[model samples]
Target: MNKRLVWPLWNLALAIGLGAFGAHALAGVLDEYGLGVYETARNYHMWMGLAWLILAVAG
Candidate 1:
């Protein structure tokens, strides 16, 4: 694997893991507003990871 891709892949993997954790482990723990916030953060993380991956691949 390319060294440039490692960080991006790790970022994406972590984002995915956190997303799953938030969806499953945190399902009943967080309130509606908190869940919304978590989802927003997760989405941002995922997007940033994707952006990094693209940049790593294209640059």
Candidate 2:
């Protein structure tokens, strides 16, 4: 695969990995409020990664 093509896929994979870690590994580590912030970050990361994936494909 082209290097440009691979980068977005890698980013998406990383985002998913991070999101999973946030949901599973972070449970009980953060308080409710902190967890909310963590969740928000994960959500943004995943969505932005998805956007990157889309852009890569569309371009």
TM-scores, all candidates, are 0.98, 0.81
Model 2 off-target regions past 4 Å?
none
Tens digits of per-residue lDDT for model 1, 1-59: 99999999999999999999999999999999999999999999999999999999998
- RMSD of every candidate to native, in Å, equals 0.4, 1.3
lDDT (C-alpha) at residue 20 in model 2: 86
- Candidate 2 residue-wise lDDT, 1-59, digit = tens: 76667877887788889878878988869889988998788788778888887887788
* Candidate 1: residue 22 Cα off by (Å): 0.3
Evaluated against the true structure, the overall lDDT of model 1 is: 0.99
**Candidate 2 — number of clashing residue pairs?**
0
Candidate 1: C-alpha RMSD after superposition: 0.4
Candidate 1 Cα misplacement greater than 4 A, ranges: none
